[model samples]
Target: MLRFLEVFAKGSQIHVPVGSPLIRKIPIFVDEHDVTAGAMKLIKVLRPAWDTSDVKTKLFTDGTTNKLVGCYVEDSPEDVVLVRVYGHKTELIVDRDNELKSFQVLHANGCAPRLYCTFLNGICYEFMQGDALGTQDVRDPSLRRLIAGEMARIHAIHAHNGCIPKPNLWIKMRRYFSLVATEFTDQASNVRIQQEVPSKAVLEQEMAWMKEHLSTLGSPVVLCHNDLLCKNIIHNEKDGHVRFIDYEYSSYNYQAFDIGNHFNEFAGMAELDYGLYPSREMQMDWLRVYLQAYKLFSQKGEEVSARELETLYVQVNKFALASHFFWGFWALIQAKYSTIDFDFLGYAVLRFNRYFETKPAAMALQIPQ
Candidate 1:
């Protein structure tokens, strides 16, 4: 299940292969070396645990990103301790804000994983013990509302950054598109990824079309969980609430993009079955709960209308194209550089294909004046 090959450190820069050995080490030598070294460091310095000798750890292999995850089994299993090895950042395509800073903000707001300590190669945090909601759990009306409330709390978090007025849709995507082009150019030099993906011209055309249409949506900019696939939302049966994890892609963006991106996730995870996309009724039901919760948490009582919801409904579906294009082109970059073994090029094609198939109908939606 290891996604990376070799990770070598050279000076301040870490040339981590598709998978880093340090990450793989924790799982392989869970108790003897990996857990003992991590546990002793935590007890003497970070956070003292029940007993280091009794501690046990295991690798979590569900992630596509090559971060190594080791869960500690200790005195109280409910108090989960997770050690996460960092992935290489050779490609800083997006204008990423401080990942650690954003994470602390969410944790302080009581909505993210609780941090324990930060080490050179990895970090440790208290894992929220819960079931990672699947596509079916995501569709349930009550659980959907709970997840909506969590997103509202996240969007309301005020994290100041150098990008004065958060980057607009076009500005952000244009930069990422440029990076994708560079990746394509780089991958073309190698024979493995030479398969025909969407050309630069086609992406530009699609971008132009999206910019023209999305301009009319006029959604307010907010702090968003740029990535909200089902796995990120964990439902804790003990407390009957959902807690969100993974803030690496968190940013200030159109509310529509966040909501649309999440709704798009209803389509199967890992399997790439577009047939699982949600129905209009299901999405509208979700939006009503989302907007209501968002307003409630922000201490605003503005009445949301069925008509207003209708407009947002049209726009979120329209905005969903950005999610597909964003990750689709992103996969091209990963195809060239990622240590993960997944078919990055094939994934890109699926995303772009969804974009084209959905664009015409989405662009044609009628919003009442």
Candidate 2:
């Protein structure tokens, strides 16, 4: 006995019944005017149309100018529409265009949800309906193997008409880390920490590690979903398949980085505030399956060996170190900006220590010349 509402902005008002199932069948619509009014207007319209008394909406951003707001209705089985608003009009348009392009690519490959519509300021797609696979489930051998295989399948599709964007992994990481370090350093003394700033010495050490291992990382970059986390993965029980959502971080990078990131998420070591005992045996099993699947689709797979896989594992550990350090610094700054609580800094510190504990073994895995 539940109904859905479709609220869209056009030159004139387009209305459908408040309790119509047709609303659930169509995508939410927005135009240039919708972005101008911000997300509030949309929420206001939805509130009455959906006849919800306990609906709440909130916005979240990573200190970036572009913000996305999620509108959730309590105790409702209706679709959720995420409204993205950007500080700068130009930036908003550009982001929407990129989203449309990315959605088209996935749709063409028959791998993702269909894009329902778009506008000058934003785009909308079918909401993925399923249960999210949590960190523990993603770490399972069978599930990890399946995930690895699907990722390879996604990467195998050549960029349409052989067009590819420049790989920006290293550059983006450098900028992100720089911002984090500067922000944390400004607030170090306030937290009663003797070492107020992230040690520049540590950053230099990680940079040196990356420079030293560049040659062995991988060759001919492949498409990478750089931000593979547990929440981004959805499990469709009906079809028994795993689907990855959120491509805002998609780019071309060394395939090994993707593998390492997935492992890091499964290990649940990113939070740094908590300890995890991810099974090494399970880790190895996932790696073997991933590499095998990669080989099935990659030309370079023919040259890959077990030793190479071990080496990649070590290198990924280095990447993990750098990533952990970057996020720790980020958390520190976030605390200073009042964007987060003091616990953020503590979590960063704990993660850094854990990475340090594992660094020696990771380094020892480096193959001899």
Candidate 3:
């Protein structure tokens, strides 16, 4: 059994003005275009005594949306902080206030890194020491257990004041749909949208289909990482645990949706290959571990019955379809607004194609009564 421990440092006691209870509202703003310069300024505010000249910086380029830079001194590398500059117009897609609340909640429970402070357009936080799990790294059985356990721990978190959490999926997807531009300003993208993207009417119908069909599956609404891409999982080999990063999409959602979303990510983003999507046997094994950990964390009976596993299996696979539709539309919106150098339209096509390909079988899955 993997034990959840408080390995991360607490949020820094930066006594700045109040924005929220958990975040220090630092008025400084960082530009995504000039990440290095912006990162240096934030680091100075966070660490005034440290020698700015000797500070070494590393730009993490793997992220598709935001700019990430690590600032640290050679002698005190353990004290490194990550500077994350929000991508251009990402606020249209991401709810920044909700993201901060999610980060604070997770950090308090020791499931995430401490959030240092918030800037005008970004955030600075502890740079966790771990390898961001790659496509193949996630396939390892040992790492898979850690990922399952960590996810269960996150799902176990309760909303403040003992209030029940409402599922954000339907409303969020609707908001994304509303934000998606009808026609792109870029000629090439405009043409691609016209030729390849689904009509708004079709998208609306599919959204309704997901809500009507999947809503009755009886999957519990819990805190979800909503976007558990391979890159978002950080595994520390030394600590023997995994920590999930990037809370931009974190919210109360269908528990099976989180697991299914993660399983979909086994295909990866950069070089997407749905062929790598986990097999039934692999999913069963993963779900077994997750159910056990989830039971343990939630203080339920740890023993998982065959029916319990089967029900989750059915729910997760079906919800995987919803994941595809969610991100496919998300990619379409990103294509219109993002300045990132990735094929957002192409990514959208892959997701939509997979959604249709897997629809019949996933919809056919029935929970063992």
Candidate 4:
């Protein structure tokens, strides 16, 4: 049996050993509170040959979930390495081991960035060049097609061992529900949860209703970046391609759920306006491109038909409700455990409120006979 020891190595004295008890040493160091210092330390180990003194860092403040810092030398700005510090107690919400495996799989398939290494509470990886897509940018006709094509390629990635893909939606939602707290240590937080959030029993009823209704949607199971918010999508104007990042929520899931979740994100996060949610006409256009690209990538030779587009249109709209419901539970759990300063309880309320408000219309969508 091997044990982990936290022996901090100083200067250039570093050791990477295999199966030797006496020489076992912690490979990387981490400081969650002081991410800049931690990022520099990580860069030293990641690029041992580079002059550590010449390294420059930029902290990306747009991310609400994790601390992201880009470290690079001045001469080679494009070769930046991103250091990601996991949010407080995020382990309760994310499966780190699974996330690593998913990253490797997507990287191998050319769908994601190269993962450098994993430390105590974070990861180092290659930084891609691009601007994160804005709300209006996604609505642009040409960019929308590019986004759809990229998503189709991602969904077409082969499953491990050629085994059938299984949906992670219900399983993850159930897990998140289990983690949602009934009370908080802080009086204000506890009071807020009690007054704003639904009761555990009510949430359970909604979950059951979703499973009963959505299970039979006929949506295929595919690898998905379950959380495909606007910021998660990076567009490179030089190459005219878009790449999805943040694998913390990536998994095999219902296809419509992935697309529908992305549509929900059209409302934006900082200040949500569901009025911005894509119209039925807009979704039809997006789904057409996605279907054609999915067929081409998956090697399905059939021509995409109107019926096919209609089918997915109905399925995606219905699954949009699941997206709202899934994230509602996730926010509740974050409210209880996350150290991030965001109003997680308020986010949860918004999600659940949207879920309730849209349920009537979303469930009303039906496939043509």
Model 3 bad stretches (over 4 Å): 1-21, 184-189
Per-residue CA lDDT of candidate 4, range 235-283, in tens?
9999989999998988778899999999999998878889999998999
Candidate 2 at residue 19, lDDT? 37
Task: Please name the candidate that would achieve the greatest lDDT relative to the true structure.
Answer: 3
**lDDT of each prediction vs. the true structure?**
0.69, 0.55, 0.85, 0.82
Ranked candidates, highest lDDT first: 3, 4, 1, 2
Can you tell me which runs of candidate 1 are displaced by over 4 Å?
1-44, 48-51, 90-97, 161-165, 168-171, 183-187, 190-194
Candidate 2: give the clashing pairs: 272-351
**Each prediction's TM-score against the native?**
0.82, 0.67, 0.92, 0.90
Model 2 error, position 162 (Å): 4.1
Backbone collision count in every prediction?
4, 1, 0, 0
Task: Please give the lDDT score for candidate 3.
Answer: 0.85
| Model 3 Cα lDDT, one tens digit per residue, 1-369 | 122121111111111123435567788877778888988888788999889999999989998879899999999989988999999989888878778878887877888798999999999999888889888988899989899999999888775344455677887888877777455334444777777877767878899989999999999988889999998988888988889899999877899999999999999998999989999998989999999999999999799999999999999999999999889878988887788899998999889889989999998889888
- Model 2: runs farther than 4 Å from truth? 1-80, 84-103, 115-123, 160-166, 184-197, 269-277, 299-308, 329-333, 336-343
RMSD of each: 8.7, 10.8, 7.0, 7.4
79 in model 1: Cα distance from truth in Å? 2.6
Per-residue C-alpha lDDT of model 2 across residues 1-369, encoded as one tens digit per residue:
122221111111112213322212223444433443444455554444654445566454332323455565766644666665433333311233334445556556655665544433444445566776776788666677778777877666565334443444555556556655543454545553346334756665765676466435543466666667677777777777777876655655666667666666664533432234455666567666666777777665544577866765666665665555545554544445442224656666665675677677666666434
